[model samples]
Target chain A: MSKRLLFVFAALIIATMVLSACGPKASTYECTDAIGCVTVAPGDPIHLAYDMVINGPDATLGIDSRNGVEIAIAEKGQLLGHDVQLTGEDDGCSAEGGQASGTKLAADTTIVAVFGTSCSSAARVAVPLLSQAGFVIISASNTAPDLTKAGDPNNWPGYLRTAHNDTIQGAAAAQFAVDFLKVTKAATIHDGSLYAESLANQFAKVFQELGGTITAQEAVDPNQTDFKSVLTSLAPGGPELIYYPIFVKAGSLITRQAKETTGLENTSLMGADGMFSPDVTAGAGDAVEGLFVSSPDTSSFSQKYNDYFLPKYQELFGSEPVSIFHAHAYDATWMVMNAIEAVAVKDADGTLHIPRQALRDAMYATKDFQGLTGVLTCGPTGDCANPKIAVYEYHAGEYPPIKVWP
Target chain B: MLRTWRQRITIADVVVWIIGLSIAFVVVYGSIKTIEVGKYNTRVWIDLTITGLALGGVYALIALGYTIVYGVLKMINFAHSEIFMSGPFTAVFLALALYKNGFWNSHPYISLLLVTLLAVTVSSTLAVLLERIAYRPLRTAPRLVPLITAIGASFFLQYAFRGFFGSGLQAYPELGFLKGTWTFGSIPVYKTQVVVIISALIMMLILYGFVQLTKMGKAMRAVSEDKEVAGLMGIDVDRIIMLTFALGGASAGLGGILYILLFPVVHFFMGFIPGLKAFTAAVLGGIGNVPGAFLGAMILGILEAVGPSLFLDGMGIAAPYQLKDAIAFIILVFILIIRPSGILGERITQTKA
Candidate 1:
């Protein structure tokens, strides 16, 4: 009996080792180019890196963006007759970690391009280093206006993004408040971060431009739980709409507090892309029933994304992709590969003479390239002039796009 | 001989004095300038102070836990922070379960009370168990061994929670009973803030009474003074140490619930910074000194919330707002450098005496 037990244990150990070795291997893509006369052999692997700090592992936003990148890489096959390799790092969506990760990526010569940094703060830290290193950085969800705008030529150069900046989204939100909701008086609130404050300011500016009277502008600490005072001060005015361009955590609390205090059952509360998540719905519960938000429509995007990449992602990660950022990341990988292919040249010696700087420049020269998000054309400032923004309303515990703004 | 030495201070003393004075001057000047600039906006100051105080109450509660544990064990309970974090996670889960059962939505106060009790009981029990499993065996081991083990335990608990709860921030449902604001003069005081301050003060008073008036408190004091001596004097030193950890853990649990009530977003690694700040407060208040920890927490809270607007505001420096961690660390360094023994630490005894 003892001999039999030892044999069984040894067999189990061997089986476990064999099963572990059979785990999914990293997928590779190869892009080959044939010169006028000769066919070039496969070159070195094309490296693509993605950086992001999701709210946590369960965040659908990061998953969606990551899935988008994976699909794009899979479709590219390869670059410059080389296998395309991809790696990702989490910046936790903070400025410090973003800078560190950006510096580390810049130091690595293997990395040709990067798709990342869903949060604007992360982009602010990365754009300078990556641009100086002549690497292409394409953000799927960074919407800070100052980043893409040529206002500070010294700061941003090779930075590009597929998502609409806060300028466009904020204006669309303001228009929705004025036209759809018919709100003449409005108040704006922000969490004092660059993303929140900038979007809030832009929304306030646009709302005022549209002949809407601005009643109040308040800044709350992001760590703060209570907004009773701020809500109370604005409650008396009974503004037709309260615009909040903050993240899910704070946004949910403010929504609940605003409803409870102001009894604003009819006073429309509007939010931006930051609050456009299922987490917000869960956090605010019934308080988010009538909440309105403006961002890229994800319902259509989710279907297309799942159709092409769901099987691959599931086979590897054992989970379905979540969030719109992943889709943008997938498109970003394709954009980089296309640019590399456009500039790569094969020499007589059977070696590929690809200048990274030339590839970066070609990325800027991309015109009318249709992407997963929308039609993309890299403008002079490296901002993709994708003018599609949709207004979503939380109904039946899901955010459904009510209107697509022009 | 003393007069000669005093008149001719060492160069090292001069350098230390300069560094300390410079930092103090900078902090003082910055705070004064910010307040002066915002003097016209009294409401901002009021708003800043109220927010600071509310957060300070929670800090004080957590700091008390660290101080009490340190007082008896003479070892930093690095896992205490994770204990604080677990309270909110447990409370939120309990509240959600109750809400789903139609118990919470109907009687919010009863649900809150029950959740608080549950959190305290669980946290205290976990604290005692952790001390026994992770630290008791290493009690006579090199001090560094237990300290390192404590840190490992902290990380273990954090990742364990993350694995169990899913890494996303879980939002606590709003309690209608804890909603609304009280207006005093032109300033608006949140009901949550009032509750946090009242509860913290009441808990502190009870703690102070327990330490000073109770027989178990006397035994604790004896153990803190000299564990072996207390054991020889008929005190169960081991029992006192366990009780100390339980008491501290209970306070931390209460703090966690209050924090969630205010912030609503609870996560796995949420206890890290707050734990560090609470530890800093304990050090600043003279670790083992309960009242001092409370004072340190209040000071740290005010500096965090009001420091940027009051000090950095005038320089056109928009507070990074996220640099609260940086601010807390700088204060901790300053305290260590200027007053290593803390604000109320006892002087070392002379062997000759």
Candidate 2:
């Protein structure tokens, strides 16, 4: 009974070891998340990483968002009873930058969620990697439409943004032109960025449909400074209004140069949210006066944004909201935290187990999430912006542009 | 020379010539067709020309850096762009502070001069430092070694600047005096453009006078002609080369100020594009020739500003400005094909021969 029974017991133990090594565990808490799960040890901080353009020409957009995230963390105090720790890589607001950051961040298994890819071009490369890594990626200022469109190949699973889709923005801009500005003849310039190109295209389409004549649509390199040739090209038609939805550097250059162009003397100049910054006033000098810009309506933000958020943002970052998307970022952070609260499983030992796909599902399930932006609802495609866009007129040397359109 | 070229022409050469001829024909034809269409008025043409001249003036100055450095070292200093970046980037703070204190507007010309001096000093110092740290030790290495080192040094300097001053786009305060336009007879030219163009011409004359009239300039030219021979003849080759970098850096720093007058946003990565264009200008002008750099830069500026509409608008290309770079590089390619040594490159060979 001793030797034979001992050999059989040893064989059974070896078989059990093989099964546990190669297959799924039998007795531990079963993870039903479609992609995967993150099992946090007791007392381990909840990990969140931002992959945004925190350092570049577009820094204000991402830094403002990062500040919002930071303030959100400060406000929350904890996430699922675990200390929330934020870390990030700067996307540099370029495709190569996104690839570098995405490749770097995707390798980490502990990152529960990623908040970033401030630009759509960065998102094009980053979202695939982050999604494949089983992390729910949300952005605060990625407004390109194809990112969350239902059938677009760019619309990857587990990707979402609190930023208004450029479809909404472009349409709003066109509406403003037709209704308020009373511009029949229009032209557009884009910087060839995914965001700028799409926004410009959307504006042109909507403008034409609204019975406005689009004289020309032009594009320039984001890094290029010379816009004389381009602006002159925009002039021949003598369009009453010119819309160039581009970033800060090129936008300022265009804003200044358009005035210098001969036929555009009395023409109205407009740019999108990407150019909405104090930097514009600084860069464009006096040329910025009477220049119109379209951005998410900041006045439509929840009451907390003015009272709590602004003062906290001031205390933390020691400046006014540097860009238009800070509220969106704050909303994105709160949305992520709310999802973590819903999906994170707590253990008796204070350990937190967050199923990766479950967190994404919880985020996708967001509805009427009263955010600083407004009441946000996440659809199947994961767009969660209330999206009230308004056109504003800039006085030279001004920080916040005065709202001119409803 | 024509006979030799004809005799030596191979199938590949024939193909290249055909491609080149077609491009030239297309350009000529497109330009004629644009004039016939006449969408742009004379005022527009005059404006384009003025802008081009101003831009080209800046490019000519920047190209001087590349030409002088290449003339001496016979190696491309890829990091020269960073040197260009370092001067104005550092000087931006001074300009901003001056503006903040109301000195920029009330004492505009003095402020301008001060900013220009700081930019020149910073750029020249950075150039000398770059030559000392990144290029000097690698001088004896394989030619490729120094080239690669220049690239690595370029990255190092960019990131270093980024680390020191956070990578936000810094704005240079505009001079109130430089605002609006000053009338020249019946024509109106922007004060900024006028200043840029006139200063460029004046700077060019000064640089030309320096090279032609100064003993150090002769030493630099001798070193460029033959570094070893010049060294054997008791010329301090290292000193001349350092002088060359300093001269180039000064031009670049001055060029940077001119550049920001047109485009005011300054950042760590700002030098990459203008640097590339200036390098192209150097190559276009015949890399080692001074006047060639200036000539090439002027032509390029005009070509970039006016070429798109003149070359493609009649061709019925929508948004011809979108193809501005394409039009520019194509013209550059044709110019090089017809004259491989560059528009002013013949002098270098003639002197060597």
Q: Name the best candidate (by TM-score).
A: 2
Candidate 1 structure quality by residue, lDDT tens digits, B166-203: 88767777787777777777655678888987888888
Model 1 chain A lDDT-worst window of ten: A29-38
DockQ of each: 0.14, 0.63
lDDT of each: 0.75, 0.89
Docking level for model 1? incorrect
Q: Against the true structure, what is every candidate's RMSD?
A: 10.4, 3.7
Off by over 4 Å in 2: A1-27, B1-7
lDDT (tens digit, per residue) of candidate 2 on A36-69: 7898877889999999987777888888889999
Question: Model 1 chain B, poorest ten-residue lDDT window?
Answer: B344-353
What interface RMSD does every candidate have? 5.7, 1.4
- Extract clashing residue pairs from model 2: none
Clashing pairs counted in every model: 21, 0
- Model 2 accuracy (lDDT, Cα): 0.89
